[model samples]
Target: MNYSLFAKVFVAVIVIQSFIILIGGQLNIIRVDRLIQQREYEYDRKDMLVVQDAYNHKLKQIRTNVLSLFFDSTQSESILEKIKRYKGTTKAEDLTLQAEIQQFLQSMAYTDESIRSILFVRNSDEQKFAFVRYFDPSLLPNFESMISLKEDEFVKVYPVDASPTKQVLIFILKVNDPNTVGMKQTVGNLVVSIDTGFLQIEGDPLHADSIIELKNSNGTIRMSGNSFAADISQIDLDARKHDSKDYFVTQVDNTVDDMVFTMLISKKQLKQSLFAMKKNQWMTIVAIVFLNVFIAFYISRALSKRVNTVTRNMRKYTPGEFVNPILIQKQDEFTVLEETYNQLILKLSEFIQKEYVMEIKSKEAELQLLHSQVNPHFLSNMLEILRMQAIKENNLNLSDTIYQLSEIFRWNIRNKETVVTLYEELYYIEYYLKLQQFRFPKLQFRIVLPQNLQNQRIVKFSVQPIVENVFKHAMNKGKETDIHIQVIEAYDSIRVSVKDNGKGMVADDLDLLILKMQKPLADTKDTPSVGLMNVHARLQLIFGEPHGLEVQSQIGEGTKVILHIPKNEVGP
Candidate 1:
């Protein structure tokens, strides 16, 4: 073949390959996205497994320490009987018990945040000590009232409060102390509330992706290993349908109760693992494509420069300053390309100018979209100031709360419109609460987020404002306030809850608010309450009518707001 014709054929082949490569690159990108999701699931699952193991180990440790204390050679039924029988109405015995309990707790590596209370109830007089490094005399209760009557033999019981001031696991032991053991008798019950505050993965970076739970033989969740809501009952029910290894069963402590032990890893780890695998694959493909494009461009440019020289001379044949137009000696594809390039450029310029005018004219129609025009720079500064003030006033909690709030806003501004993994959202909430807590230090707030939700993606700020509202209206005004925030991840959808112990709204207030929250600004004469209205509007925009804010509140009791949003918003 002629060299020129061969050159043309080579260029055509290169162009075709480029198009094919582009399609393949996009396909690889798609594959990588799916793989990354899989890896994320896997990582999350593995993390959950690790967390479960660690938690069970800790629980076992607590159980061992408590049992050992009762079963020690120094402790006996007679000794325990004497201690119970010798108790006086005066706070003297209570003080002795408190000292012993505190000494035991400290020796056993139990921090104040972990052991909320240690109480010893006697037959004649009741005395106990409740200390978390500090004293809580009111937490002492009658040992007889809290005892389990289900079994006749000496047994250890883990009792969750009917209404826990905080999410914690409480362990109760009824065994012989030294005094009672000497008399060959078992008398008083030793009750210790192992506050789960210490159990929370406070400084752990991966806490959001981890989960732990303790389950009974009946599949009821006796106490959770982590701060997550108990789903061990469901795990047991679901496990029955599958083989043993694949199923979720409670990790066993055969020494204590011989409960079947198993841990189903969070599926998020699997997802993460798969995602990493695909990321590697796509990254390799991208690198290859990029190299191919670079080589192709270099070769094409060399050839184009030669052709341009010939064309330039032909155009300048009669030129001094202004050059003569190119007179083609032959008609071919290059001639067609030259003609089309000039015409396309002309048309593109015209189109750009037209679009510019149209964009300005359409600005009026886009007033609503302008809500996204918030300047993060200004907001960040304000948050810093708020945090500093909280710290200066001995409001470390409030300072942390402000910091969290800033983080939520930062994430919102920085990661706009991108589908965030559920773990990411939890992180945002954790920080948001740090800021809110500074404002309401007396309020009790706990989050029971799903451990396996790393695979799921949600709209940003999905659960934030509902939590904000709890503090704004209900939590800040009251003393001894409480709120339980839980995020339940289901197969089809995710449920977000913000339940508060505060003065709640009446039915008519609900009626007026719900309607206003849902309606557009034009429809409503006035804005619904700030936080609620913004949350309602944002959720409506993202999830549409299928998911919106639902509030349940009774005047004297409290408020519970539930947000239900679909799990699968985008295809992998």
Candidate 2:
């Protein structure tokens, strides 16, 4: 997408951070959900325990009150004797005993609001005495059917419908003759009906959909705190099914009765709570991601700005032009790079200045040397006329001398080429030396050139300058100055050496002359060694090093100057 550094950094940081945050948030949500489930389970368990305890306590209290009514000093003997003496007789005592029992039951019902009715049955005639409160006659048959008890059971509790709308818990106790031992003799039965409403939990449930159920071991519900249509047993109560239709079931077994107390808490409320938590967590994660992206953007922008500054400065630079150094406020890697670039620019500037000036000077020296030469046509015509005049007078030596001078002038003037063959240059050098011999009769010279090297090409005036320097500076006044010019070939280049048995320079003078030749042409222009320096500079500027001049000399030994030239075919 060609995204900039800032965008790349910001996106990378946000993506990485958001991924981590999302993963961590998901894990946190799972952990919190588990913790909330555990808390709900424990809370529901406590509520079930509370309901169980209350029911057990109420049952125990009912049992105690009922037993107290029979076992009381005044009531125990009267009720036991009356129940034992009764045999379905309509005597005044029996009627009176039934009236007393009814009055006692009424009193007990008035004292305990949970009690609905009490029944007394005589086993001798199967006659029933009942004190009914808010009773339905239609339910009398169902109540009578549950009154029968097993011979070995002392007491039994059952949940039965007292009326179409009223439900009660019936506690049946067997009345036995205490005077008879071994197999106790049955006298009567006492059945107390306590309203099932007393078994309900008192307080509101923990959640709106929470239900508390009281059921027997056989799964028949006796009482419930909340009205629920669906059977709790049919619903999936697994905690892991929180995402689906599920409930958290908590059950407790009552010690006073063979009953189970269950609390059903719907997962709908839990799911809602978890969704809200996840929303808040995602909001926090998004906020953190944005903050991190902002920081990354700021850092990337600062770095990009520094890099751009460097690039802008570099773009402004051109060869042979000055460039300003980059100014960086911070001392970091960029600062080091800026400093290195500045140093490189400075070195480049110095190199360009040196090479540029040297090129201009070399061209100016060549033009000046060319302008100083005599007009070729006029010099050649005058030299030929002088040679003809010497021949006309029969002066053979003078005519030959004039002819050699004309040949030297013709070679120098007629050739406009920058390069020439070694043989042509040597022909010019021989004529110049012959003319020099005319001036100094003691000057003697010999030229030795290999036949293969005759066609070696060099700059036109390369050899003449060194030979002129030898003649001007190395010639002795009176002694015979023997000059030997020899050409040698190497693997990659050619060398031309000029040796002379003349007044050779001392070590100090030779060193000074060599130093002057190596200096800039402007510095040596007024010096006598200008010709030598011109030749050295031209060779270097044209061919580059190591294609220049080298000199060897001593106080007594003659000086030898070698011209190093590259091997090339003669120019057309």
Candidate 3:
């Protein structure tokens, strides 16, 4: 009853638990942060790839349009006439022709702001004229490459001016004209430049200070955008590295072997919020630790006091004092235990007194039942008197029935033992069937049992009561009853099943009858099927569980009752 030991154990356990929790919490915070960063990176990669794919598709479209222009010129047999209309007349150049040309150039820009400029290089002038989206007609950058173009070509990435920061990608097409018969002549070249900024994609977890860049086959960056600059060669795939004072770098290779996308992230800007989160979590941990210690101390003291109180009450309690329980006011384990202990003592006393009285009454009731068992002999003796009188009249069938009835009583009266040879029981059943046939002339019965198993023993009255019960219900509407009895010797057990073709019971009533057969001897007192219940209980007593009467019946078909008994446990 020394609760100091319990207090010491509680304190030690709580201290160990607190240390483990602290270590686990720190590790958890680190792991959770890494997972968050990983998820952010995954989302960023998807968004960046979306932008890359869409941008590539747009560039392909622009190339297709330029090729269409070339194809159109080849079909125009009067291409020289159209050119002369624009080039030959000064009023045509100032008004109708120039406006039409400018309108076509503007249409090439479409709604995409990334297409900064469009140009038509005559190859005859070696000078290029361009129409920018916002500015007036100006010379396009990287127009020098237009001189050598014979077929369609995608040019290398071009810088805007001296600075290679804001780059543009260009495609050039070689145009042909069909003005001269039997000859195809080269016409002006068509060139389109796309601004790189339009390829940038921004999404959640992708920082503004993060740069996304794509590199082509020559290791030169084809596209770069956002607040930071990134070198494709400096970044490695599946690796994080510091690139410069302003950025951290990572990159991944695309499906194209030579192309890769790289990102430059500002380290401080990306991790500042995470750092703040770690600080708050650390503060929360400290508070939790204090709360845990206070709770552990309070619980330890309260449990120690409850243990002392229980110990004192138990020591002071005597037999008579069980009337008043050891009471604890708080609704906790100790309170429940004390109340249950007192209630248990009270119930135990009551149960013991009731059981004592019931045992004596049960013994007395059993003796009275044994005395009451004499009633059947009076009926048997009357049948004996009838047989004597039938013998006097020389009526053989009447005498034979009386003789069979006498045999049944003799078998019942003989030792009142639970078992008889299988042959003896079958013989009595045959005699009983004769009496039943005399009673019901149309009823027929069949018995199927192996000759070798006839000498085996079974519960004496088990088969008789089942047949009697069947006959009782089997006479429904006076329809002829056909009874089939199968006594088969199985692998580990013996089965005696009685199946009758008669008006069988509905499910609810059949359930009640099966329930009676299943009950233990002590539970069958109130049920109406005493004879069958007695047989079922005896089989269970002799052969153990699952060795008893089984009932099966349907509303119109028939009823089947199988008596299951262990072969080894029954007869020799």
Best by TM-score: 3
lDDT of 2 by residue, 282-358 (tens): 68777776899999999899899988887887888889878777765788878888788878888999789878877
Clashes of 2: 0
Please estimate how well model 3 matches the true structure, expressed as its whole-model Cα lDDT.
Answer: 0.66
Task: Score candidate 2 by lDDT.
Answer: 0.73
Error of 1 at 65 (Å): 70
Candidate 1 vs candidate 2, lDDT winner: 2
lDDT measured at residue 125 in model 2 versus the true structure, 0 to 100:
76
For model 3, residues 251-351, the per-residue Cα lDDT tens digits are 66655234566665665665776677657765676788799999999999988987887677667755533445556578876787777776776776656
What's the lDDT for residue 80 in model 3?
A: 28
Candidate 2 Cα errors over 4 Å, as ranges: 1-309, 324-374, 520-530
Model 3 CA deviation exceeding 4 Å by range = 1-274, 277-289, 298-365, 376-382, 455-457, 476-478, 511-523, 526-542, 569-572
Q: Is candidate 1 or candidate 2 better by TM-score?
A: 2
